[model samples]
Structure formats: structure tokens, C-alpha cells
Target: MEPIVILTLLAAMIILLLILGAPFKSFKWIGTGAVRLLIGALFLFFLNTFGGIFEYHLPINLFTASVSGFLGVPGIVALIFLDMMVVN
Candidate 1:
């Protein structure tokens, strides 16, 4: 399948999750809006490189560490997933 198609599907899935409000509570610490997204992207990047792949893959410290004081998880998840798709 084309990369674009895969991306579209991924986007659709994320949107569906948002609409369904599935376990978003875990992400509440992320705060609200674009700032959260920006941080998530930075976090996702540093997480893998600075902390290593295992660290990034695991959630032991991700929730507390990534949230950075407070909004939503989608922005973070979106940033991470978007970078993953684009980078790899």
C-alpha cells in the first residue's frame, strides 16, 4: 500500500479514537491545544534518541514524563505517530 494511504488510515483511526473517547483519561495531563502537540513531538523525538527505543516504547515514565504539567493525549499521540510515519 502507498504511504499516503497508510497515513490516511492511521489518521482515521486516531480520529475515531478521539470521537469515541477511549481511555483518554490517561492523557489528560497533557494540557490543551498546539503547545501540547509541540511538546509531544519534541518529547517523542528526545524520548527515542536520548532515552533509547525501549524507553520510548514503554509507558513507565511516559505518561508522567511526557505530559509536562498538563492537556490531551491526541496531540501528543498525533505528533509521535506523525513523526513516526514521516521519519520511518
Candidate 2:
């Protein structure tokens, strides 16, 4: 994309946020969500690392991260199920 188009889209996004009147609050939620994503990723990393000892490893990528991030513990469980039922 052109720089002008990028700027326009960015400006439009900012304007929309301002119109919504909760930009800062939304950013707070974004920050919290980002933290959750990181935590979930780290949890999966540790799980994969430890499972390596047992010759079981879960693939870590955007899909898994999003799953774990959005769904929390249930997401981890689902990944485990996938690993056991599908990958294995």
C-alpha cells in the first residue's frame, strides 16, 4: 500500500476511535488482551518444552496463540486434545 493510503487509514481509525469516545479504555483492554496473549503463548511454550521429554510437542503458532489467548485454559485443553487425537 502507498504511504498516503496507510496514513489515511490510520487517520480514519483514529477518528473512529475518537468518535466512539472510549479510545483510552479500548487501549486498556487491548493492552490487557496483549498481556493475556503473551501469557498464553508462554504457557504453551512451557508445555511444549516439557512435553519434549515425553516425545510430545505441540506446535506453537498464530492459530494456537489466538486459541489460547481468546479461550484461556479451555484453549490449552483443546490443543492437548488435538495433539492426542490428531497429531499423535
Candidate 3:
């Protein structure tokens, strides 16, 4: 599909949702979650990069990203602990 067509469709969807009075608070949470997810993914990427010196690394994937995004710091710790357990 063309870019213009896609954008038009998106705009129409937004207009329709607005006319229907869609709850925007949920959208706010979704946006926030997306931002947090990106941050979490980047955090894991950097951790593995610098951690190479300490012989530490964490696999960055959808599962890890979602976990860290939803659970924040504790999720990363959990992944580390799980990695250690599996390795040992």
C-alpha cells in the first residue's frame, strides 16, 4: 500500500474513534508503555555491551523486552537470575 493511503486510513480511524468518544486514557497508557518498552530494550542492549568486560550478557528479545517493560527493574533482575540459573 502507498504511504498516503495508509496515512489517510489512519486519519480516518482516528476521526472515527474521536466521533465515537474512545477512551483516551487507555491510549495514554499504551503510549507510555511503548516508551518504557523502548527504554527497557535499550537498557538491556547497553548492559550487554558494557557487561562484555565482566563476562555478562543478556539476550535482548521480545520476551525480555516485554518483561522489562511491564515489570521494570525487577524484570531485568529476574532475567539475570534466570540466565545464571540456566547457565549453571
Question: Which numbered prediction scores highest in lDDT against the true structure?
Answer: 3
Question: How would you encode candidate 2's per-residue C-alpha lDDT over 1-88 as one tens digit per residue?
Answer: 7645644664565455446644576586765555556556666876776788998777777788778878988999998998789877
- Tens digits of per-residue lDDT, candidate 3, 1-88, equal 7645644664565455446553687686655565566666766866787789999978878788778867888998898999999876
Better of 1 and 3 by lDDT: 3
Stretches of model 2 off by over 4 angstroms after superposition: 1-23
Between candidates 1 and 2, the one scoring higher on TM-score is 2
- The C-alpha stretches of model 3 lying farther than 4 A from their native spots are 1-23
Clashes of 2: 0
lDDT values for all models: 0.47, 0.71, 0.72
For model 3, the run of ten residues with the poorest summed lDDT: 13-22
